[model samples]
Target: CSNKSGNKILYLHFDSLIIFHSITTISKVSVTAGKSVSIPCLYDSRYMNYVKYLCEGYYWNYCNYVVKTNKPDRSGKYSISDDKNQKIFTVTINQLTNKNTDYWCVVEINGGSDHGESFQLSVSSGKNSGGMKWCRLGRNCVTKSSGSIDGTTVTIHTTELNVFTVTMSGLKPEDSGWYWYIQIPVHLTVTEKLINSKYCKRS
Candidate 1:
């Protein structure tokens, strides 16, 4: 089961009468193409001395290493720093592109199971004049022209500065997951109401 508290997410798993808790700082992030973003990963105090790293992939077991606290990338595309006093580590990715999709903040365990939390990254060109589409992952996208989908209504408005604001109405509890704005994948949590929305840019 998963529970969200503020910007942190707690995931629980049970195996062999043991319980595991995985907490993540953020679930999703979006950046303009060619831009950079810094993601923060918070961990338990017990992992303060452990190795922390950022890996990229949709699956945890097969994610490719992007950067680590001990091994920083020489190419300068990625870097990680751990703040032992704060129990948090931050990963910075530069010159992001659309290909940067899923990633994980992982805490390494020497002789036991590792702990991790996954987050999705979305990149947009900000040069598409055709406006944008709001989509649920694996489902059809809803455009301003289309107006609605599956009992939900999505309205998009563009400003003179090319900034796009998307409003989603009639959200249910099941709508609480990943959604995309123009190619930007963002996580939205719906409880008594919609909790998050993204302001997209298109030129």
Candidate 2:
């Protein structure tokens, strides 16, 4: 988590009560297909039984498990879990598709209350895409003199976002290479378009 101007950017999870003693922000995330991603959350207690806290909510939906109706809506796609004593709730999803779906995690606190957060799932619509690509200001993809490259490797601990903004400058002929990446285990969606030539120049 990074702090800018005394504001802490943290990802909220679906494990705890809706109301909190302190103001906590849930950082958005992107995930890929056929992988398990952890939806981030926080709580004020040391106990990890957040599934109990969810009982306060009016609705609880999980992988083929609906608390209210006992009937499956969409089977085998979601589930809930705990992580040590961190009060973090882990939501596991499997067999991702290209369907632009929005997942909702609703909760309640102070007895008979409710609140929610949502995450988006996006699939790659084009071929030959870049992963978390970096770009500079006023530069083409092949021009090394115009932009800088962050390369293809992603350091998970470096940035606290499922969404990354890529920017570069002075992209010269030598600057042609694969610049970005999207990790499936992290639930990420990447958007890429051609800035110059179809192929990167290796001057």
Candidate 3:
């Protein structure tokens, strides 16, 4: 969870069962800006009795970096609450930013090495405000393209060209991904329809 490398191993032992700690459950992996979200995590049933020993390490402002201990405080704009004895840890973050942040839960077995699990908090906004705006070359087109929607929108700017607006409306569960684009324009003046979606891209 904390380590994006995903190369680490965590093990726990309880009641001579040699229980290895693992993440049993998780909540939504991503969320929208200014929206409330929860991260639910659980441990292996064998280690349920020791659930009280679990603690959460939340990345308050950066990517996968823990900024505070397990307690509600003003130190950062976030809160952590859960029933450790029930093996349920819920981390509620407040006022997410454009930056990426992640959270992890760890438990150190008494007199044993610590084992942990983590989840990512995907933060997004209704509409991506920064990106290339496009339109087609035409006069009869609605002639509107200055606002933002939660989903994709296309506009005609030139009679021979096409325009597009990208957005993520009504935020859904399957909209998570890193989108890419490659363009090769055709006819100098053509009747065409364009569609676009807001997304994160890697160069």
RMSD of each: 13.4, 16.0, 18.3
**Local accuracy of candidate 1 as per-residue lDDT tens digits, 32-127:** 789887777767898999999898998766788888888889999999998786576878889999888789888977766667877787677865
Q: Go through the candidates in order and give each one's C-alpha lDDT.
A: 0.72, 0.37, 0.41
Q: After superposition, how far is residue 55 of candidate 3 from its true place, in Å?
A: 8.9
lDDT of 2 by residue, 1-203 (tens): 33112334444546763333321213233555555444433333532332322121122233112221122225655555544454444455566565524554433332333333444555443332334433221121322212334443222221444444444433344343222233222222244555887587868
Q: What order do you get sorting by TM-score, best first?
A: 1, 3, 2
Which residue pairs in candidate 1 have backbone atoms (N, alpha carbon, C) closer than 3 angstroms, thus clashing?
none
Query: What C-alpha lDDT, on a 0 to 100 scale, does residue 157 get in candidate 2?
Result: 20
Candidate 2 matches the true fold with a TM-score of 0.37
Ranking 1 against 3 by lDDT, winner: 1
- Give TM-scores for every candidate, taking all chains together and pairing residue i with residue i: 0.54, 0.37, 0.39
TM-score of 1: 0.54
In candidate 3 the C-alpha lDDT for residue 79 amounts to 58
Report the lDDT of model 3 for residue 149.
Answer: 27
